[model samples]
Target chain A: MATLEIHDLHVSVEAENGPREILKGVDLTVKQGETHAIMGPNGSGKSTLAYSLAGHPKYTITGGTVTLDGEDVLAMSVDERARAGVFLAMQYPVEVPGVSVSNFLRTSATAIRGEAPKLRTWVKEVKGAMERLNMDPAFAERNVNEGFSGGEKKRHEILQLELLKPKIAILDETDSGLDVDALRQVSEGVNRVRETGEVGTLLITHYTRILRYIKPDFVHVFSGGRIVESGGAELADKLESEGYEAYQTKGGVTA
Target chain B: MADNTPAGSTTDGAIQVGGPQQPIDARVSAPASYDVADFPVPHGREEEWRFTPLERLRGLHDGTAVANGGGVKVEVSAPAGVTVETVGRDDARLGRSGKPVDRVAAQAYTSFEKASVVSIPKDAVLTEPVTISVHGEGGVAFGHQVIEVGAFAEAVVVLDHTGDTTLAANVEFLVGDGAKLTVVSVQDWDATAVHAAQHTALIGRDASFKSVIVTFGGDLVRLHPRVVYGAPGGEAELYGLYFTDKGQHQEHRLFVDHDTPHCRSNVAYKGALQGKDAHAVWIGDVLIRAEAEGTDTYELNRNLVLTDGARVDSVPNLEIETGEIVGAGHASATGRFDDEQLFYLMARGIPADEARRLVVRGFFAELVQQIGIPELEERLIAKIEAELEASVA
Candidate 1:
């Protein structure tokens, strides 16, 4: 059974000319433990999909049903959807100064788990997770995503995922603005998620850099408000060379 | 040494030595004149006290009919998630010694409007410091403040006295047991205000009290801070900072009483007086009771007169009734800002305003950082910037 199912999802924003459609009926799905990568051009409504799924107040969902493990996901609150195992690693992580990263992650973990744990055990668990992700343990005590480099923000998101252990994680262009070393660290963190049994992922990116480490089981192409084509890993290669022109053609695969 | 002799005393003429060279003039015992009835203030009956112009004291007291009104009333122009409320349900006697604050004297100002208050629930661990502004922009602004730090509770309270223009204000604080409270009060008024405020605290056992007061404005401002340690195992820290420019007069008076055993008290007040005839004073007194065995007491007052015409007078007083106390000491000095700290921040490419802000933040950071509330701390940083602009902008 599919872990996540997106059916005819449409989104728009209230702009000067009225509802300017951003996502024009995109549909896709992923089964349990499978990783799917969505490759798109700029302004292709890629980040919109991530925001709409996370229930950010900015993105308006004009139509669609988003289900996670057969549960209706779109009807939940932002934090509720978060608690329901839908995680979005934001491309531009907000700088929440004064709120320490450790404090934020711990609170998030507690909120997700629905109970409080011992401080000693919580610290140990956090230490172990940071070690697995190669993050400085002191970063946890620093303010949340505040004063962090681009790479550090990405790593901090991964740390949260590790600590919270969400069922399905969405990486919104996490590959952007990363150096080779930072990219490797991030890919390793994602790979750890995949190895932890039954964890589903949706990697949204403009570049295929991260795909080199965490191979996607399926690849979907998004353009002009819809999914133009879907296939195996070769689809990524074909688009890489031909540059999405073939997918724009009228005869392109419409599903 | 002769230097340790009592002020205005003749050591050789004493009929009998009470203890040592220090005069034991029974007639000149420590003055307990701060009681509600006899305390000397501008409320009534005096001429040297005629300095309080009615225009300045306009709304300082309730008319002949009503009891004293207490509560720091503030109607915020912004609808943020903060509200000002009274300290408790008892409406009449909100820390006035039941004397309606009007008859108690020493008030150059009182609230014309009804009093306002804020309450943090019992055992409520409010991580953020609750900032209360006794904002008096134009008219005479007189208000009261009552704070209750519940049992086993911990909180940080920030009171900022400021105005769009010149103004005056009064505030009071009451704290409860096994509870910890830290208050940071910054006064940034227009150059014309004559600000006079008083703070009284009654602390219980196992509780900690901390206060940082920074005074930056007022033509003539006086602060009287009194604290009474009502039980054992209590700790109190008092700190003050004042920067005066151009004919500003700021004074701070402290009275810390260690009435029981195993108590600790410390006081530090520093200031910089600049411009022609600018003046500042630090008057502090710590009292150790007969039963205050194993008590530790310390006091320090330092001042810097920046310009040749500016002046500062600091006085630290300590009276020990028991020899069994572990420590009792006092220090006072009046002097300019640290040129080194300013140069360091400037060399780091920080602009003058930002550098000034950093210096100011660091100067107060010892207490500001101790505030555990993330959101409140952020707001405090912003408030500090706003005050700096008002003063220097």
Candidate 2:
């Protein structure tokens, strides 16, 4: 079982003018087998929280304490955090030319598992995971994210999420460009991992559509770079109908 | 010396050497000749020698380096039906494909004592590749080699160069009508070696020619590979990969002349440079003449700069005299490592050095696959890994 605690997290990014704070003293905690959906409008600093937790150099953690199972996650490097079982399924997966999908997956598995996976079983495992996502077997040989459609890229991210089996998985806008069918397929993948009961998922999105498939244990209304309200699944239904306009008007948040 | 104009002369009054004064061809200014005097010594200002370090050539340009008998040892092994012979310079089959176009090549032609010739008989399809190993012992040496495939014959040849020496050589490939030939030339010389070589191939009617040039070693290595078609329907594919390390200079200049109608050609070269003073140069030139209608050609060059102080110069030139050609295109790009790419790989738990290795290896994987030899391909990949290890350590 793993636990992620983010207390008073303050993140800033360098803009043309100067350093601008994005995450303003946010607090959140996620335990293994728990699903947390961070609902927000545009520029609500939802993705900023995702990348900052992943240790992106662009986001500076001005003041925060992020710990994973009592380890200083904020002090660890991006790769070290990954090896420690923190996975981020990026919104726009980068295109790595000439690197095949099979090689990338195997290398990642080796890094996390501390040894290369058994070749025979690993091949079957990859083939099975890819088939579960309805991905073509030929996709394994193609370069990562190179020439892949938007839906295909999302499915690839979910495929990694299923295979890496990280303790804490952050899905950043995984449902942004996905269609209805792709959304259902991707959500099914997340739900399969959720059923494992050994992973904590932090699904960040602007729409409540994904929450319909993967029910969140808690829904947090993010506004002005911080979560202003927290409630049960009923809160999501409320926001879906009432929309984020109430929070923006109450917090005087622009966009 | 006064009568001979400098090779770099661009003045209107500068006279052409060893030939009657006439309008210079825009494509190639210098005329081809077997005589060393016909080509003047390059003074670093000439277009061809601008990117080269002439002082490191060890006298290959000025004709002062005498042939040291044991400088290089040549060994050739062919299958039973193939003919391999060491013939004198006066052999009638010598210089049949193309003449020396530069001073070093002309000097090599005038200086070499014995030439090695490998011939594949008509209608013969080789099951095994013919291997030629040139081991540089020491001192200065010049060499000439010819590989000819008979009509309808298909053969693959491997030319391997190793050891240390100051050497200039010329290689020719004569692909007969309807023949298919694949050549792999590897320059894995010692660190102190200096090498300059010209590789020319003349493709016959309806023939196919493919060449893979892999350069990794030597202090200063300049290779000029040229292709010319003898008849229409001939096809040529040239692929090259080079890894330049600290204080090394590697240059590859290619020319594909589509003088015949309905011919096709494609050239692709990729290189990686690391450490201080590591330099790489790629010049690709494709010329489609007026009579060569329906000609299809494309050339591409890409370079990966691994570290600071490494330099890459990539120039692609395509000249078409007639619009009746099928297509003509060229592309060149030199770039440092992409940060997002590194981040993407590292975000998956790969270390920084290992991620760099993966990206660089991926960059060259396409060209390395063109070698078509499993053992050689594996060895090249190993060499690339070793090169990466040096920097990572």
Candidate 3:
């Protein structure tokens, strides 16, 4: 079964002066068939944790061991880790002008699976996936993220998540730039993947709107580079009622 | 410094032309003045050929462009419903209505068949592109061609330059007003071929013309595509790509002129160079005239040098008078594979080589997609894949 394990991970980015730590000693684990949510205020290292896990060049890992089913995750290349079942739904999917969504999806699929899928089966699967997410088939032929509205880019990333069938998916603010309709469509896409029992979801965001659709089994309050508090899904509900102002004041400086 | 001296005459009364041969007596040649015979060799005497390289013409007849093993041959089979007219240099059909400039008095092989003119009638919309195939398997052959698209007509032309032998070809195009013409030229010559080609285009008012050249073959290939608008509302776009490897020299020189008011033109060319002696050159010149008010023009030339041995030279120029009657600008830059863009792709699950390929592919993929033709784009990708395979070999 697929599993994600992040242990004492410290992340930092290059600042004007020098390296400024963003994620400090953050630790979390989510086994297959479970969805976990990470919520925090701005600069609380939520997105940093997600990007570091995805192997973005900008974020450097100070110290940590990210494992997938006991495999050394940090040691794998970004694509290798992806092959090993890690997927990241980026906050801002880059607008690649000429690469169509269909081409990108097919390439990504071939990349993750190590070969091209049978045309009939793959076409059917892609069509079904789009229909389930309330996405039009025409969306597949459009250029990847080019000329796409904010919500469209986010949904497109989810479409990739559905097609690649990754075991572990880190949704980095999937709900940040979506209208109500787009938010529901994105959440539904995440839920459909969970329903298949083939993927695990790591929802990273500050909003509680998406949690209403893809309920998280556990909610972690990320304060500094580390998770300061962890609890049941009620914690997300609590944060939805009360803001992150107090959490930022409590241990934010140390973060 | 004699006031009585003619424009090109030296005090010796002999015209000293700065070309391959030494000064020729202007008096003996002036009155009769340049029969096509006078242009046995191309020198830098004429304005159009001022910046041209005379060294390239050193092997005119003596240094034959040897054909690849078994020899090379050229054949032109255009799509049906598209009429093809073959004209020989002696046919007098390829001559311009205006004064003839004996720049590179081209010699299209009789076996090479002077040139062919393809015509797409007015208002005729062609679904398939006209495929012109050139085969060079024997010795060397050079070709000259002229194409005309009638007003309100739409057509695509595919010029496939393939040679098992060496070849140098020149192509020229003229599009009538309000016609839409798309020209996709592919150069997949044998690596043994040394290719030097020139293409000129004149776009009439409201005419939409696009020229795309995919360079991959030949020991060395130099292509120049020039476009000048006839009047306001005319449009022209030039897109080019070249992938060169060691022992191969590929260069592209492009000129887009907004000669009339309200004309628009855009040009973008990207290339990748690899191997120990691979070289790529790009010169983009956009000239806007003072009277060409309210014209819009932009140009960009980008190059990618994949390895240490590869080299790229890029130059983007913009010439505009003090009058700012329109929007005009130009940009040019050469970059190796960006470590960050690569890392980003790799992080998303693409391997290093594949990542570089994808980014490089993505680098030019944008332009290929923007091209109105799809099959030619596939042909381009396939040609690049051949380069990849050869490099690996």
Candidate 4:
């Protein structure tokens, strides 16, 4: 089983004025087959934590310890983190103009799996995954995320999640901009991966709407770059009814 | 000191402007004279010669460059119904497609001993392509070649250049009515070679022509491609792809003159540069004359700068003299690798270097497919990977 442990993670970004801290001191852990929802308001460093774990160069790790099953994840480069089984479904997936989805998927699979997948079987696997995600088969030939709709982008991220089969996946705001039907389809894809019982899911979102589909085992209330409160699944119900208003006040657990 | 000389001449032009802007009239259209003596030697001041280093030309711009006996070794492979002949200068078909607009072109036209003419008969559609390979052994050389396709014929020509030489040559394409012709010119010379050439295409009524120019080797190379419509309903597609390495200068200047009604043209050129002093220049010019109503044209140039010191200059100009034209537009973009694109690929487990190579390959993939030759496309892709490998090494 794989476990991702992030302790006192402090990250900063180079803003126009100077280096400003985004994640002050955040702590979280995700074990195999578990789902942890990081709920936060806008600009609460939810995406920053995701990008930092993915080793994005734009996020500077000032003071932190990120380990994947006792191995130092902070020392690994972006691709190494991926190879070591840490996947990130970005909030904004970048558009790579000339790379087809099929080629990009195969290349990514080869890089992570350490060998090229057999062509015939790999094509079958991709077709099956795409069909489950409600994607057109012709979408494989389109450029990666180029001119894709909001719902399509979310579906593509989940498609990669299923195909790559990483040990730990941090889905950052995958629920946003998706319609009701698209949200259900994408959540179904994520649920399918979770059913394998070998991957940990870090579902990050602002609203608790997605929690209705893919139930989270642990709920963490994040504010000002740190987890202010942690509880069982009932906390999502509380956040759904009361919102983050209780966490916004200084040291208020009044709710 | 000449009384009729324009204001932008040599030192005066360089000192007065002191910038990248060119004088209005100095932007060369078609010149009136094709004689070698008619065009004056450039001092790196004119718009066309501004990016070119004059001394590196080896006297090709002036009349001093001569065709030594040790020059290019030309080989030709023709299909069953094709005719290959070397005609002398007095042939009536010479210069019918275009006149020499620059000093290098005029010098090449006046210096060549004889011109190689490859002709395809009317209504002949060959299954096999015509291949011409020009290998430079040594010394300086000048050449002139014309590939003529008769009415209703369809042909593809591959002109491959290899080895080292200081060469200046002119190539022409005459596509007859209802004919389709595709020409792929590859400049794969030795790293020390210098090459200058001008390509002209004359498109007949309802005819179609496509030119694919690929440049990789050579220390300095400059190519000028111009298209003129002989009748209405002509269509032309000019696609170019080049890889510029350290200390190499590769320039492509194109002009598509829409002088006939109902004619259309499209130009797209993509390039990648790596290492210090690697320079790539693209100049796209499209002019629609007053009488040419119903004209449609668009040009695009995209450059990917792979290293710090590599530079790219992209200029796209569209001149429309008719308000009745259908459409005219152009775009030019030069940039480094998109970091977000790299990060996205890497986050999916592709290594940094592999991710970079993929991005560059994708940048040129569209133009490579426009070539319409699968084997050459694969070879060009391999060449691109090899070039990227050297950069990392």
Candidate 5:
């Protein structure tokens, strides 16, 4: 089983005034098959933590120790982190004009799996995964994420999450632009990967609507730069009705 | 290149092959000649010569460069029912498609010892492509080529250039009535080689002409492709792809003259520049005269600057003298790598360099596929990959 530990993480972004700290002394730990939901209002350093963990060049880690099964995660390159079983489903999927979805998925699979998958079986696997996500088969030939709708882009992200099958899959705001049906389909795709029980999931969102479908074992209420509250699944239901007004102040409350 | 069949029959907003023939009312009787003195020398200040580096011409423009060099070795492979011949300048078929419109072209016309003419007979269909390999044997050389497709014939002609030399030449295409032709001209010269050529074509009544120019190597290369309609219902498509490396300058100037009624033309050119001092230039010009009613045309040019110190100047101009045209438009774009695209690919586990390569390949994929020649397409893709590999090594 994989274990990801982020201890006292401090991250900053280049702002007009200079390096502005976004995540200050935030800590979280997720084990194999664990579903951790990070919920907060806008500008609460939620996405910053996600991007920083993915090693985005825009987000600088001022002080942090991120490890996966005792292996240094912060020291890895973005692609290296992915090869080391870390998957990031970005909030906004990028459009690659000429690279077809099939090619991109194959390349990514090759990179992560350390070898090119057999062509016939890989094609079938892709067809199966796409069918599970309700994606059109024609999408395999179209350029990656180009001209896709908001819901389509989110579904594509989940498509990658299923195809790559990383140890820790981070879905940042995956439900933002999704409709009720699309959200259900995407959550179903994620749960299929979760059923393998070999993957840990970090679900970052602003609403508890998605929780009704993919239940999170742990709920962390993020505020300012760190988590202001931590609890079990019941905490999500509590925040669902109570809102984050109480946690907006400072110093989290334990469950 | 999956479907290498010609594209004119299927394109929308583009003229279809074969229709009723009509008179050419906007034709200009150009002073066709092999005399360099008939054309005035360019001072690099003229509109056509502005972007060209004068000194880089190696005396080809000023009547100083002699054709007494080792010259180029030309080889031709023609299918059955085709003919290839070397004729003197006085051959009746010579200069029928077009004449030298500029000083450099006139100079080339006057300098070449003989011209190679490849002709496809009427109603002939070549199952295999006609290949012509032109390798520079060193020094300054001037040459000319004429590819004539007969009525109701179909053919593909490939002009392959390689080796080193300072060369200038003129090429002409004569598309007969109801004929279809696709010509691919590849300029793969040495790093020190300088090559310039002007390609002219005359589309016949209900005929289709497609030109694909691929330029990859050369210290300095300038090519001008011009097309004019011989009668109504003619069609023309011009496609070009180039890669400019460090200290290299590649320029493509195109002029499509809609001189007849119901004629159509489409132009698309894409280029990539890498390394310090690398430069690329694309000038697309389309003119529809007053008498050319029902004229349809569109042009597009796009460039990718792969590194710092690289520059691209893309200019697309369309002039319409009549309001009776079906369509007229042009576009130009030049940009570097899309960071978000790179990030997306890398986030999926592909290495940074691999992602960059994939992006570049995608940028040119559409145009390359339109070439419709499988072997040539594969070679061009591999060449592009080799170029990217060199940047890191």
Candidate 6:
């Protein structure tokens, strides 16, 4: 089992004016087999937390302590963090030209597993996972996200999440741009991995529609670059009814 | 500066006498000739020689270098029903496709003792490719080769160059009416070698010609591949891939002359440069004459700069004399590695080195696929991987 701990995380980005802090002393903890939904409005620093933990290089960690099973996650490189079982499903997955989906997946699997997967079984494993997401078998031969549609890109991300089976998976806006059907399919994929009981999922989103499918063990209201309230699933229902206006009026800066 | 001095006394006199005296067509100013004296000795000032380093030619441009016999061994292997012969320069079929437009090519034309001619009979389809291997033996050499495909014949030919030598040669392709020909010319020379060659193809009525030029070696290599249509309804496709390493100069200049109506042509060349002082030059010129109506042509050049101090000069020139063409367009781009692409691959647990390799390989994958030969494609991919291994180390 794996556990991730983020304490007093402070992140900043270089804007045109100067250095501007985004994540202001945020704290969170996620253990294996636990699902945590970080709910927030626009510009609430939710995605900043995802990219910072994944070592995006664009985000500067001014002050923070991130540890994965007592190992210093903040000190690791982007790829090193990935090899250490930290996966980030980006909101807008980059388009890598000329690299086929199959090759990318196999290369990633090799790096994570420390050896090449058995060819016969690996092919079947990929085919099975892709089928679960209703992906076409021919999609394996296409370039990774080169010309895929929005829904297709989301499904591809979930496909990787299912196959890689990282210890901690951060899904950033996976529900954005996805239709109702795609949302249900992608959520089903997350739930399937959740049932494995060996992975911790940090699903960051602005809507509570996804929480209806994948129930979160805890709901955290993110405002002003920090979590101002934490509660059970009932809190999500309350936010869905009352909206984030109350928090914004209660001294929570817009960004 | 004495006006009474003899006209041919100074070194610049030769350039003045051989160069175009008056303003001529910008597309092709120098007239094609068979004699070396008709063309000027390039002093790196002419438009064609601006990007080339004349000092590295090893006397190929001027008349100083003599042919050291046996410098290069030419071997030809062909399937049944095909004829391969080493005929003298007087062979009536030689130089029928195009004339020598440069001094080095003209010198090669006049100096080569023997010319290899490969002929395919009419309507004969070749199952196996005709392979011509030119192995350099470390000297100055000149060569000429002719590949003639008869009417309605279909054939594929592979011209492979290797080893070390300062070589200049001319290769001609004659496609008969309704014939289909594909040529794969590879320049995989030694690191210290110098090479200059001109490849010309004359497409016949309703015929098709495809050329894949792959260059990966040689200290200084320059290739000029030109295409001309013999009659209407001809089609030509030119695809090239080159890898320029440290201190290497690889240049590819292409010209497609659409002199006949209803002719179509497409050109695409991609290159990757690595290490310091690595230089790559690509010049694509397409010309559609006044009488050539309904002409369609497009040219594209893309270069991936892999490291610092590497340089790429890509120029695409299109001159259309007729307004009744279907379409004409060109594009050229030279860029370093895409950071977001690298980040995407690395974010999936791939190390930096492997990610770099993937991007470079992906950049050239399109042109490599145009080879249409599985074994050759695999070999080229392996060669690219080996090139990456060096820089990574």
Best by DockQ: 5
Model 6: per-residue Cα lDDT over B44-78, one tens digit each = 87878888898988999988878999679999999
- Candidate 3 C-alpha lDDT tens digits along B190-261: 887766666777787799999988888877677778777765688888998888888677878776766678
Candidate 1 structure quality by residue, lDDT tens digits, A1-255: 448899999998888988888888888887668899998877778898987887766679899888988899888766667777778888877643234566556556665777765799998988888888788877876755557999998998887777777778889999999999999999999888888766789999998778898899999998877887788888888877778666556423334
Candidate 5 Cα deviation (angstroms), residue A245: 5.5
Q: What is the DockQ of each candidate?
A: 0.01, 0.55, 0.25, 0.60, 0.68, 0.50
- The lDDT values for all models are 0.65, 0.88, 0.72, 0.88, 0.85, 0.88
Per-residue lDDT tens digits for candidate 3, residues A1-255, read 888889989888899999998877988988888999999887788998888888877888888889989999888778888888889898877754345677777777888889998899999988998887777899987866667889888878888888888889999999997888989888988998898887778999988888888899999998866788899999998899997877877756463
lDDT of 1: 0.65
Worst 10 residues of 2 chain B by lDDT: B4-13
| TM-score, prediction 1 | 0.49
**Model 4 residue pairs with clashes:** none
Q: Compute the lDDT of residue B374 as modeled in candidate 2.
A: 85
Q: After superposition, how far is residue A9 of candidate 4 from its true place, in Å?
A: 3.5
lDDT (Cα, tens digit) per residue for candidate 6, span A200-235: 999999999999899999999898889889998999
Q: Is candidate 2 or candidate 4 better by DockQ?
A: 4
In model 1, which regions exceed 4 Å deviation? A248-255, B1-210, B213-393
Cα lDDT of model 2 by residue, A1-255, tens digit: 699999999999999999999999899999999999999999999999999998888999999799999999999988999999999999999887667899899998999889999999999999999999999999999988989999999999999999999999999999998899999999999999999999999999999999989999989999989999999889999999999989997755754
- Answer with 1 or 5, whichever has the higher DockQ: 5
Ordered by TM-score, highest first, the candidates read 5, 4, 2, 6, 3, 1
TM-score of each: 0.49, 0.83, 0.64, 0.85, 0.86, 0.80
True contacts kept of 3: 0.43
